[model samples]
Target: MARRMVIIGGGAAGIGAAGAAKAAAPSAEVIVYTAFEDVGYSPCGIPYVHGKEIPDFTSLFLAEKQAYADAGIDVRYETTVLGFDPESRTVQVEGEGPSGYDALIIATGFDYKPPGVPGEDLGGLYYVKNIRRAMEWDKILDNVRHAVVVEASPLGLEMVTALAHRGIDTHVIDPHPWALGELCDPDIVAPVQESWAEMGVTTHWDTRLLGFTGDREGHVRTVATTDGELPAELVVVATHKVANNALAVAAGLRTGSTGGLVVDDHMRTSAPHVWAAGDVCEIPHGVGGLPLQGLTGSHAYAQGKVAGTNAAGGERAYQPVYVPWGMVAGTWMIGGAALGEVAATALGVPHVVGKATGISRARYFPGVRPVTVKLLAEPRTLRLIGAQMVGGEGIKERADFLALAVRKGITLHDLASMENVYSPPIGALNEPIVTAAQAGVST
Candidate 1:
C-alpha cells in the first residue's frame, strides 16, 4: 500500500508540502485540510488589496480548489483539525468527515492579538490576519470615511497607507517612540516618519491606546489614548502575532520558549511521524542562529519541502539562507542579526561601528531615496558582523547581500574592495554596502 500523508492548513506551507511530498513519493496519497474557504491566497497581499494597488483581491490566489484537485491532492476546505494523536498517528478533523494518516504536517500559521482595551470589541474595530478578514475589510472600507490604526510595525504602516490612499482621514498610534522601533535605528526612522506625513498619515508616537468608545449601535466612535481621545469611524489593531500551536501543544509536541513549534533541522516535531512548518514553527535566522522574527512564504515553502521529503523516506534538512524583506507603501525594511549595537546586545557581543545614509543609485536618479546603513564590527578585529538598511525600492535586496556578508564573517577591508553592478538608473557607482563597509573600516 502507498503511504498516506495528511497536511493541515492549506496555506503556502501546506500546499508546498503536498506538492513536494507527491514528487518525492509518486505513489503516496497526499491530503490537505484548510479552515479557510480559499487555499493558496497570498496573505501578504492583503494590504495591497486595501490600498487598491491590486485591481482585484482574487488575483492573489496562486491556486484554487480545482487546481489542487487536478494535481491529485485531496483538498478539504472548511475542515478544522481538532487535535493530533501521536500513538495512533491520526489527526481528528472536524466538519464533513474524519480521516487517518501515516504521516502529518502542521502549518496552521499565526494569529494577531488585539489591544486589551475596553470597547475594542465594537462593530467598527478590525484586525486583518487572513483572507476572510481582508475581504471583509474591503467591503466595510467602502463606507468608512476615517480610520485609526494602532501599532507602527510594517503592517500598521501598510494599513495607514491604504486608508490614506482611499482619502480616509487616518491616524496611526503606537506606544513605541518611533515606527519600526526595533527594526531601524532612530536616525533612519526620522525620515520614514516624514514620508508618512507626506503621505497624509497622522502619527501619534509614544502614545498608547487606553480604550475605545462606542455609540448606541455598538459601533466605534472614538479611540481613547493616553494622550487624548480621537474621533474614528474604524479602528485597526496591527499588533504582534501569536503562533497557532494549540494543536501541537495539545499533542505533546515540543515548542520553543517563544511559543512556536520546536522542530529539528529536518522540520520534524518531537512526535515521530509528525512534522511542522511555516509560521507555526520557530526556524533559524539567516545570518545568526537567532529565531526568525516572523514567517514568510519563502521560508514556508522551503520548510515544507524539507519536511515532506524527509517524511517520504528521503533525507533532507531545512537550511535557511535568506532574511525577511518587508515593504510598506514604497519603502523597504530588512531585518536580520547583522552585528549592530542592538543585535550585539541581544547576542552578548561587544561591537561598535558608525552608521551612514547614502543613495543606492546616483543622487540624480529621480526615484532614489536616502538609504540608511548601519555597520557593526569588532573594534579590534575590524571584522564586519552585521548591517541593516532602510529605504525605498532596491534597499531590501542590498540589505540582504549585506546580511550574507555578515554571516560569512566578511571583513570590512574585503567588503570595501567588493565589486557591484552599477547604473545611473539602477544603482550608484559606489554601492551603499561597500560605502558602509568603508565607513566601518575608517572608524
Candidate 2:
C-alpha cells in the first residue's frame, strides 16, 4: 500500500512540506488542502503591491495550480479541514468523508489579532491577509483619501507608508510609546519614526483605540482614540499575529506556552505520525531555548521541509532559531538576529552591549550611508548573544551573519578580529560589526 501524506494549509510551510514529502517518498500519496482559493503567492509582498511598488498582484504568484499537478502532488484549494481524529489517524474535511493519512503535517498559519473594540465589524476596516482580499482592498485604496492604521506593527507601518505614497492622509495609532516596541529598542526605531513624521504621517503615539465610528453607509468615518477623534475613511487593523491553532487544539495536540503546537527537533507533534510547522508551531530560540512563534516566511518554509522529510519516513532535524529579520522602515532599513536589547530585557537575559556607527562604503565613496551596529554579549564569556542593525544598505547581510554567528557561539573577540571586504563601491573598509565587537571587547 502506498503511504498517504496529508498536509493542511497552503502557505509557505504547507507548500514546502508537500515538495519535500514527495521527494522523500516518491510513491507516497501526497495531498495539500487549503481554505484559500489561491496558492503560491507571496503574502509578504501584498504591502508593496498596495503601496504601488509592484506592478500587479499576478506578479506575486510563484506558480500556478497546474504546476503542482504536474509534480504529482494533489493541491485541493478552497477546501477546509474540519477536524482530525488522532486515534483513528484520519481528518474530517468539510465536504468530504474522513480521509486517512499515514502522515499528517499541520501548517495552518496565522490570523491577525482582532482589535476587540466596538464597531470593529463595521465596513471600511481591512485585515491584511489572504491575497485575494488584499487585491480587492488594493482597488478600494484607489478611492480612499483618509486612512488610519490601528497599530504600529510591521504591517501597520508598511500600510502607513503605502497609504502615504498614494497621497492619502495616513494616520497611525499605537498605545506604545514607540513603534515596533516589542521587536526593536526605542532608540534604534527613533530615526525611522522621524522619517515617517517627515513624510507627513500623523502618529498618535501613547493613545489607546477607544472605538471606530461609522457613517450612514456603515463605512468607518472616524477613529476614536484615547487622545481624540480623527477622521478616517478606512481603518487597517494591523495587529499582532496569533497562531491559528483551532485544529491542533481540537485534535488534542499539546501546545507550548506561546499557544503554538509543541514540536520537537523533528517537527513531530505529540500525536503519532503527525507533525506541525510554521506559525502553528513554537520552536526554541537559540539564545535561551525560549519558545518563539510568528516568525518570517523563510523560517516557515525551512520548518516545513524538515517536517515533510521526517513525515515521509526520512530523517531530519531542525535546530533552535536564531531569527534573522529585516525590513525597510520608512526611508531606512532595520533588522536584527536573535535577541536585541528590548528582547533581552523582556526575557530577563543578562547581557552587555556594544555599538558603533560606520559608513556602509568607503568614507569618500559616493552614495555612502551610515550603518549602525549593536552587539550584545554575555558579560562573562563575551559570546555573541544577539545583534541589531539599522542603516541604509547593509542591514540584511549583517543580520544574516550575526544569526549564524550567534548559533555557532561566536564571541565578541572573533567578530572584532574578523576580516572584511574593503571595496569603495559596495564594501566598507571599516565594518560596523567589527567595530561594535571591538567596543564590546574593550568594555
Candidate 3:
C-alpha cells in the first residue's frame, strides 16, 4: 500500500504542504480536509473585494476545485476533522470514521481574538473570515451608513480603508497612540494617519471599547468607548489573530507563548510523523530568536513546503524569519522588516537609528516623491537589525531588501557606500537607504 499523507485545513499552508508532498512522493496518497467550503483563494484579497477595488470575490480564487482533483489530490471541503491521535496515527473526521495516515500536517490557521467586551454576541458585529460569508456581507455593506472598527491592527486598517472607499462613515478605535504603532514608529506612521483623516475617517486614539448597544433587532447601533458613545450601525472586530490550535493542543502538540504550535527547523511537531505550519505555528525571529506567529500567506506557504517535503522523507530546513511586511494605509505606502525603534525598545534590544528623507527620483523628474528610510543597527557592531520605510513607489522593495540585508548581517558601513540606480524617472541619484546608513555611521 502507498504511504498516506493527511493534511488538516486547506488554506495556504495546507495547500502548499499537499502540493509539495505529492511532488516529493509521486505515489503517496495525499488528502486534505477543510472546514471551509472553499479553497485555493487569497484571504488577503478579502478586504479589497469588499472595497470594490476588485470587481468580484470570484477573482480572488487562484484555482478551482477541479484543479486539485485533476492533480490527483483529494480535497474534502466542509469536512471537519474532530481530532487525531498521534500514537495511533489516525485522524477522526466529524462524520467519517478514523482514517489512518503515514504522516500528518496541521495548518489550521487563525481565529480572531474575541473583543472580550460585553454585547460581543450581538448582531452587526463582523469578523472578516470565510469567503462565503464575506460575499454575503459585501451586499450588506452597501446599506451600512456607519461602521466602527475595533482596533487599528493590519486587518483593521484594511477594513477601515475598505469601508471608507465605500463612502461609509467609518470610525477606528484603538488603545495605541497611532495606527500600526505596534509595528512602525510614530513618525513613519504619521503621514498614513493624516491620509486617513483626509479620507473623512475618524480615529479614536488611546481609547478602549466599553461595549455595544443594540437596537430592537439585536443589531449593534451604538459603540460605547472610553471616549464617548458613537452612533454605529456595524462593528468590525479586527483585533489580534489568535492561533486556532484547539485541535493541535488536544492532540498533545507543544505550543509556544504566542499560542502557535511549536515546531522544529523541519516544521516537525513534538509528536512523530506530524508537522505544523502557517498561522497555526510559531517560528523564531532571525534577530532575537523570539517566537512569532500570525504572519503573511507567503510565510505560511514557505513553511508548508518545508513541512511537506520533510514529511515525504526529504531533507529541507526552515530558517528563522525576518518578517517583511508592507501595505497601503489610506494612500500612503508604509512597511518595515524585523524590528523598528518601538519594537526594539519594547524587546529591550539596544540599537542605533539612522534616518534620511530623499527623493524617489532625480530632482528634475516629473513625479518625484519623498521617500523616508530608517535603519536600526546594533550599537557596537553596527550590524543591520531592522528597517522601516514610507514612500510612494519603493516602500515594498526597500523593505524586502532590508530584510535580506539584516539576514545576511549587512552593516551600516556597507549600506552607507552602497551603489544604486539613477535615472530621470524611475531611479534616484541619492538612495535613501544609503543616506540613512551614512547618518548612522556618522552618529
**Per-residue alpha-carbon lDDT of model 3 for 1-443, expressed as tens digits?**
88899999999999999999988988888999999998888989999998988999999998989999988789999998999999999999997889899999999999999888889999999899889999988999999999999999999889999999999999999999998878889999898889889999999999999999998989999999999998888898999989999999999999999999999999999999999999999999999899999999999999989988999888889999999999877887889899999999999999999999998899887888889999999999999999998888788889899999999999999999999999879889899999999999989
**Residue pairs with clashing backbones, model 3:** none
Stretches of model 3 off by over 4 angstroms after superposition: none
What are the per-residue Cα lDDT tens digits for candidate 2 across 197-306?
88889898899999998989898999999989999888999998889999989989999898999999999999999999999999999888989989999999999999
RMSD of each: 2.2, 1.1, 1.0
Instruction: Report the lDDT tens digits of candidate 1 across residue range 1-443.
Output: 99999998887888888888988998899988888887888877888888898978888989667988888888988877888798888778775355678989988888776688899789888877678877877988888877899998768878888888887888989888877775655665666677778877789989988999999999999999987888998998888777888998998998887789888899999998999888898876655667763556778888888888877777889765545344654244444334446546767877767567778678887987667777778778777777666676576576567667766777888877899888988887777767877888887
Q: How many residue pairs clash (N, CA or C atoms closer than 3 angstroms) in each of the candidate models, in the order given?
A: 2, 0, 0
Candidate 1, residue 210: lDDT: 97
Q: What's the residue-level lDDT of 224 in candidate 1? A: 94
Candidate-wise lDDT, in order? 0.78, 0.92, 0.93
- Please give the ranking of all candidate structures by lDDT, highest first, separated by commas: 3, 2, 1
Which parts of model 2 are misplaced by more than 4 Å? Answer: none
Winner by TM-score between candidate 3 and candidate 1 = 3
